[model samples]
Target: MYSPEFRREAVAALKTSTLAEVAANTGASPSSLRRWVGRSDLADRPRSGRPPIQDTADQVVEALVATAGARISGKDYSTRALAEATGLSQSIVSRSVRGLTVPLTDVGGGRELSLVAAGFPLLILGARTEDAGGEDGGGGPAVPPRRIQRRIAGIAAALRSAGVGRWAQRFDSEHRQVPTDNLLELIAAGGSDRFLVFDPLGEVPVEVVAESDSRVEVHRDFAEFLEALKDLLAGCQDIPGSLLDLLSARVRNGLEGVLWRDSVGVDASRSSMSSDSMEISSWLPKETRSITEHLAIALREEIIDSAYEPGDRINPRLLSRRMRVPRASVDAALRRMVDDKLLDGSRGGARIPLITTGDVLDLYAARMAIGEVVLRSLSLRPQRYLVPVQLALRQVEASAPTRSGIDVEDADLHYQQELARASGLRESARVFEAVTLRLRLFISVLQLDYSPASDRIVSDDRAMFAALSRGDAKTAIEVWRGKVDNAVRHMAGLLGRRRFDQELWTQLTRSLA
Candidate 1:
């Protein structure tokens, strides 16, 4: 029906009617009746029925399926069996598993993951009180425990200041709250090389159709504990706590954006901003098994949350400004992004060649087949460039009387100079883009204020220029890369947000072909 009132009424009536009653009244198949109850796309006869469930709990169910994947092995668990294991409704299990795209089985209402066949690890985050939800009195389905909102709020704030990970909350059918936690883990051994966090609560999460070594799971308790900590996250309203919320959101957003920028290509930017809070260095996590692990989870969620949306650039300089951490640290984090295959770039080695003869032949053939347009554009450039170069030379002479080129004066010449400067400008832009990315990563690691990262980057640049002038591309790149890598290592050393710049970058660029 066109009117909301009509839809509401029809839905109300459909929900109350028995399955047989709907079939008798509609004279349609039971399948059609079921579809009609939920379908709103239909116009006049718009199939209406019970109100659609909020589906928020699907995240919790999906988390359960992931955790369960780690716990079970070999043969895939039946949907019924998975339902029995994670205490989720078969429908929720099915939906979330499908939604999250994590490896899972959907039998009737339950979902299962075939970790063994896929060679994927079963991930298990830390547990909380709710993952072990109370049994339903009717015994038909088990509900996740209610999350302690106030407590979670407190923890999220503490995490903000303490430089620990984030803890998010969700409610179940029984109004019980559950937590979703993400922790970073580094694996370079097998399968896909990825470093972006995939909290459904955040931005992006990869789906595990069959399974492979690319995924890792934390202790179920960690995820559960994060749920319990939700009250702490939810209740805060001031200072460190209030800022913590924003930081938590930013942390999630920034990381995910960096992770996916490449796939989305040069068309997107990601960012998150938190209000001023106390400096976090001294308060950094001190425990070996601290709640810090959840930071990765929070970041993952924010990344997933930001999927498809443009966000702040992950430039280390800006992030250093925004995060108040050292720019050097930010650079390091960007390197990690490179390592994880989430993002990629190059100063000198971009097209240097990264394949064996056979592979090179294949790569070249493929490029030749599809890159004709770009090739033509490049070939036609020199011809187009001569006039611009001559004009630019004249400008340089006008600007600095006796200079051959490099003029910043004389509009037209300056303009052509700027045009010719495009390559360098583009390079710098790309580098800064890469820098901003690393900055976010560094911020997560140092958990310091934002400015320091920028300051540190400027400091590192002093040596950077010197290194570049020496004609030592590798050394210059190394020195520049080293400072950033150090920041990443520092960030990873914190607890769970391990460094992966080297690996990620290699993987991402390697596949540019």
Candidate 2:
């Protein structure tokens, strides 16, 4: 067992004993932080199920301040005018949204986020080996092949619908038949350098919105963010992370219905396709009376979207800048909201806070436990994992030619998040939020000091897959158990052991079993 004292030592070295503050004081390079983030066992394993956003709220007094891009010019509450606006006896609007779950409900449309202008789409390119030439000439298709210009528009919509980020219409609104060769060109032109790329030898469209001038960026201290999140998870808070989940789930589910064509008939209106494509009523634009409120809401989601799973990690400041707002304004809003308890950001890695704190943890524990059970259940698919594991090893062999401006989340997370979805584990989508929460919280605390690689996740997921292929349920159990064990150890180093517990895991497993 890992000693809780490690977390104490890590904490002792900090200015405020918060992950963000300590990570800043440590002066470790971002690359080192990335590596340490994953090396809890020297292998990249995905972190999952953090607390929810409903735990804390961002309170910059939306009506008083207008969100940057929306451009609200109003006679509402500013820092000094809060008492008169809503008959509340406060002076600053910045101090208003605290501890309230329905922050936006109180402020009106002025405090909401928009669906546009949030991210650039990043699409993974691929070429089939058979297309290159037959057996004698055995090289996979060129880096990018010669094909028609096509953008993964459907994918873009799905991502946006999932609240991943806003889909950049410039390059992605419609699917253009793009050639395999112009891939990098497209990436440079419309693709954001800040993205979580998931290319497992296929044609996948994924992207990340980038943060500008990392140095000047200001954020909620990561350690405190994580600690607060952990505290909320321990039932020290009153709000619910699921409340925000309500927003995302409703939106994504609606989008998912549109994407999967779940809700429409074959001959639906030209403007209204099935739920699989464009049948997303929830995707419609909402009116914004208060730009600041909407801006804060968007930032909150952006922060969550920037979770550090493996390849996709981002800074909330990145979203703030992209939203065209001042960093101070964003932070002020976040501070006030958190001070009141609207967003719960306990995962302790990225700047985005997880809305659901405690349940997020329980969800993670439950999901992992279920994953373990699934691995054991699938003990006959060892061969199915061979190619993936081999490819992964080869990937590490290439030494990532040049590092990405944004680090990749553990491959294990990518695989498992999908598997969780495949298993039809009711919480597949919810788990995505949970995983992101931890990464966001972690990123907030570590910044440049955060280095996350998924060697352990690879080892475990592969081993379990292999075990399943081999029909060795026991081996799957062992491998998966190890994976969770390693993650717990790593997290314990960052968050106090007292912050984590067996109840969540035990309850999760009992249900899973």
Candidate 3:
């Protein structure tokens, strides 16, 4: 795990390097540090249950001694002025600055923040100030569009044998554009020397938005940016390895929601409908605000979305960049999720899990045995999980992808999560999630067409819900058992049809050892 000081150092390094490079050098993931940078809102989310009691009075006094640049300090600015800059409420500001450790010896028209005698070391860098007279947010000089185009062309030339495409000539956004048929067109037309106009805020045509295609990717910078473009293009042709890493990074930006809609088999119109309009308020818990909790959820969603597949190693450094938090926070979240059983591996490193047929069978048996007991008890207390189960059902239906493997997997996982929550067995919930993750990983790695199976999952979930409606615990348990059995057999059949990767199998054996 990374220490707080190290995390601060990594965040400070963001000044000189791109998030990707910083991650590569520091062993800190890009996403973590990104969050630590002015994106504090991501980390300040409220948690469920009791709030932690604060020694606010003491904190207010100590606030005076803390360095002004690093933290909110009386020496930096007045309470009202600081409140305006930080955009915090007056009451919060007042509570934080109400007391003083030392008497105010001077009276002046203006308040100046005082630094502590032994000022804190500069670990984390504060927010950046933009360049004067620069169009982009960065402080450096902007490279001309022609220079970027030529650089991309050179990279494309080098990667031609690897199925790299030409420089796309159009963009949806000003900085980047993902053309719908950019990959297919490049392959068909052969590589061409062309440059797309740079538009950071270009409006995508209606058709492009409607189709959710990835035709192009544009960026303002060269080098690393061009490398990302090359890998993304290569991914379109089904090449593996680093392309997966590229996808993992882009996944943080809603790549699945944007690019893979059709191939994944989603109900486009239904997806377009806002969740707010859906009747989820009755079942879905109020969303948690904690960044760690939120990151946990986001990571799970990305995993199910197949941003990183089985056998794909997670780069804590790169992941930190994607999640925009510190490596320490990412490590904490990973440990928590692993405890929850939604992820595999330990703090040494984490990966999306892989599974064998025996693992599938064992998972089913456990679910059947444990679920039976839970369902039987729920019959005596039907009120407990009933609402949550219904809520899960609603999410599955509302978010249903027409034939998407990930969507189906998500639905199944959501149902299981709700059931575990209802069972009032936190450990059980975690185990169930672990099982679900394994199954999802298997499907993603194989890229199996589980469309029909997805439909069946929803149907079975509804049957269970119907049984729950009548307080028929026995029927619900039976339905759940049948679903589990079916999943095991289905997975076993798929596994039989495909040969296992011997290398991955060996690695798994060693890891287990």
Give me the candidate number with maximum lDDT. Answer: 3
- Superposed model 3: Cα runs more than 4 Å off: 1-310, 335-348, 352-354, 382-385, 424-450, 496-513
Worst window of 10 by summed lDDT in candidate 2: 142-151
Q: Against the hidden true structure, what lDDT does model 1 obtain? A: 0.31
| Models sorted by lDDT, best on top | 3, 2, 1
Off by over 4 Å in 1: 1-456, 465-478, 495-513
lDDT (Cα, tens digit) per residue for candidate 3, span 1-513: 666667677777888989999889988766777767765333334559764333442343233323221112112345566557566555666555432211122111111111000001000001112223312223321222222222222223222212112223323332333443442232223222221211223322345323423332334333334355433222221111122222232322322222222112121222211232122211224463354454544454343322354545554543453355776787787776567655677544566666666665566666666676666655666475578778778767754556755455666676766776687766766666555545554555444555677667778889877877787987887788677766666666666655434344344333211
Write model 2 residue lDDT over 1-513, tens digit each, in one string: 223454344444543455565567665544554445444454334557874332221222331221211011111223234456445445223333332112222211111111111112323211111212222122321111110000011122223334333232234433333343344333344322221222222233233122222211111233222232222212211111112222222343322222111111222221111123211111112452133444433433333222122223233343344455666666666555444333444443223333233544543565466666455434444355445444443443232232321222322344554444333345544544345434434433322221244344445555666665567777767766666655543554444335555566565556544
Candidate 2 is scored at a TM of: 0.30
Cα displacement (Å) at residue 260, model 1: 32
- Per-candidate Cα lDDT values, in order, are 0.31, 0.34, 0.45
Number of the predicted model whose TM-score against the real structure is largest: 3
TM-score of every candidate relative to the true structure:
0.21, 0.30, 0.42
Residue 231 lDDT, candidate 2, scale 0-100? 24
